[model samples]
Target: MSLSMILPMSAFALAASISPGPVNLVCLSSGTRYRLSQGLIFVTGATLGFIALFIAIGLGLYSAMNVMPGLQALLRWAGVAFLVYLSYRLAVDDGRLTEGDTHKAPGFMTGAVMQWLNPKAWLASASGIGAYTSGNDLQQVLIFASLYMPICWLSLASWVYAGAFLRRYVQRPQVLKAINRILAALLLASCVYLVLE
Candidate 1:
C-alpha cells in the first residue's frame, strides 16, 4: 500500500478501535475492578483477537460470509446471546473490593472470545480489509494488522484507564453497583442495536 492509502487505512483502524464496543466496555469494567497491570492481559488478548479476525477476513472470511447468507445471521444471533450474557453478569455484580478476587475481573480468554463473538468487531474487520486491500493479499493484510494491533491495544487501555480513574471516586458499594448496572444496561442496549441494525 502507498503512504496515502495507509493514512486512510490507519484512520479506519483508529475509528474502529476507539469506538464503544463490547471489548472496550469489558476492558472498562475490568480496569474498574482490577489493577492496570492485571488488566493488561485482557487488553493483550483483545488485541490478539482483533488481529486474528482482521487476518481471517483479509484471507477470505468476508467472502465466505457473503457466500453463505445464513452464516451471517448465525453469527449475529450468537453475538447477541453472548452480549446478553455479559450484560447479565455485569448487572448482578455486588461491587465488593476483596483481596485476591480473581472472579471479579474477567480473564484473558474472556476478552479474546468476546472479540470473536462481537458483531461490531466482525463488521469493522470486514470493512477495513475490504476497503483497504484486495482481501487476499497477505502482505498488505499483515501490514494492516501490525499497524492496527498497537492502535487497538492503546485505545482499549484508554478505556481501562478511564474506568480505573472512576474507581477512585466510587468509594461506596452502592455507587459502584450503580455504575456496573449502567454499564450492563449499555451492553444490553448494544445487543438490541446489533440485532436491529
Candidate 2:
C-alpha cells in the first residue's frame, strides 16, 4: 500500500481504538477498582476480540451478517443488553476497593468475551476493515492483523493504566462518584447509539 493509504488507515485505526466506549469505560473501572495489571487483562481480552472480529470480517462473516436480518438483530440486542447491564453495575458500585483487590484483576478470556458483545467494538472493527483493508492476498491480511493487534493492545492498556494512575490523585468520594457517573452516562449513551444504529 502507498503511504497515503497507510497513514490514513493508521489514523483511523488509532482513533477508533482510543475512543471512549463501553469497553474503555470498563477498563478504566477495572483499573480504578483493582489495579493496572487487571486493567491490562481487560485490554488483552478486547484485543483478542478485535483479532477475532478482523478474522471474521476477512472471512466475509460481516458481509454475511449484513444480509441476515435475524443475526443482525440478535447481535444488536445482545450488545444493548450487555452494555446496559454493565452500566447499571457501574452506576451503583460503591467504588470501595476490597482488601487485596489488586490481586483480583480481570481475566484475559473474560475481557475478550466482553468485546464480542460490545456493539461499539463491532462497529469500529467493521469500519476499520472496510476502510483499511486494501490488500487481497492471505499474506496481506495476515500482515494487517499482525500490525493491528499490538497497536490496539498498547493503546487500550495505556488508557486503563492512566485511569488507575488518576485514581491515586483523586481519592475523594465526591470526585470518584462524579467519575463513575460520567462513565456510566457515557456507556449508556453509547449503548443507545449502538441499539439505534
Candidate 3:
C-alpha cells in the first residue's frame, strides 16, 4: 500500500481502538483491578483478535454476511448476549483492589473472546476494510492488518494506563464500586446502542 493508503488506515485503526468500546472498557476495568502487565496481556489479545477479525472481513467475511443475511443478526445478538454477561460481571464486582494476580482478572482468552463478541470490533473491521481495501486483495488486507496491530495495541494500552492512574485515587471500595458500576452501565448502553443501530 502507498503512503496515501497507510495514513488513513493508521488513523482509522487508532481512532477505532482508542475510542470507548467494550474491549477498551474491559481493559480499563482490568487495569483498575489487576497489574499493568495483566492489562497489557488483555490489550495484546484484543489487538490480535481485532487484527484477525479485520483480516477475515477483508478476505471475504463481509461478502459472506451479505450473502447470508442472518449471519449479521447472529453476530449482533451474540455480541449483545456477551456484553450482557460481561456487564453483569462488572456490575457485581466487589470493588476491591486486586493488588496481585489472585483475583482472576481477565486474561488472554477473555480478551480475545471479548473482541470477537464486540459489535464495535465487527463494525470497525468491516468499515475500515471497506474503506481502505480494494477487491479483497491479499496485499492490501495484510498491509491494513499490519498497520492496525500496533496502533490498536498502543491505543488500548493508553486506556489501560488511564485506568491504572485512576486506581491510585479510587483507593476506597465505594469509589471503585461506583466506577465499576458506571463502566458496567456503559457496557450495557453500548449493547443497546448496537442493537438499535
Give the number of colliding residue pairs in candidate 3: 0
Best by lDDT: 3
TM-score (C-alpha, index-matched) for candidate 2:
0.88
| Model 1: worst 10 consecutive residues (lDDT sum) | 96-105
* Deviation from native of the Cα of residue 116 in model 2, angstroms: 1.7
What RMSD does each model have against the real structure? 1.4, 2.2, 1.3
- lDDT of each residue in 1-197, candidate 1, tens digit only: 68998889888999999999888998888777777776788998888988998899889888889999998889889889999998998899888755477765777777788888988888899888878887499999999998899899999999999888888778677887888899999999999898889
Task: Estimate, for each residue in 83-163, the C-alpha lDDT of model 2 and write its tens digit.
Answer: 887788778867666647654455687678777877766777677776677534455556567767887888788778878
lDDT of each: 0.86, 0.75, 0.87
Deviation from native of the Cα of residue 188 in model 3, angstroms: 0.6
**CA deviation > 4 Å runs, candidate 2:** 1-5, 102-106, 134-136
In what order do the candidates fall by lDDT, top score first?
Answer: 3, 1, 2
The digit string of per-residue lDDT tens for model 3 on 1-197 reads 67987898999988888999899999898878778998999898888888888888889987888898787888889899989988998899888885755457887877887887788888899999888888889999998898899999999999899899999877888888899999999999999898888
Ranking by TM-score: 3, 1, 2
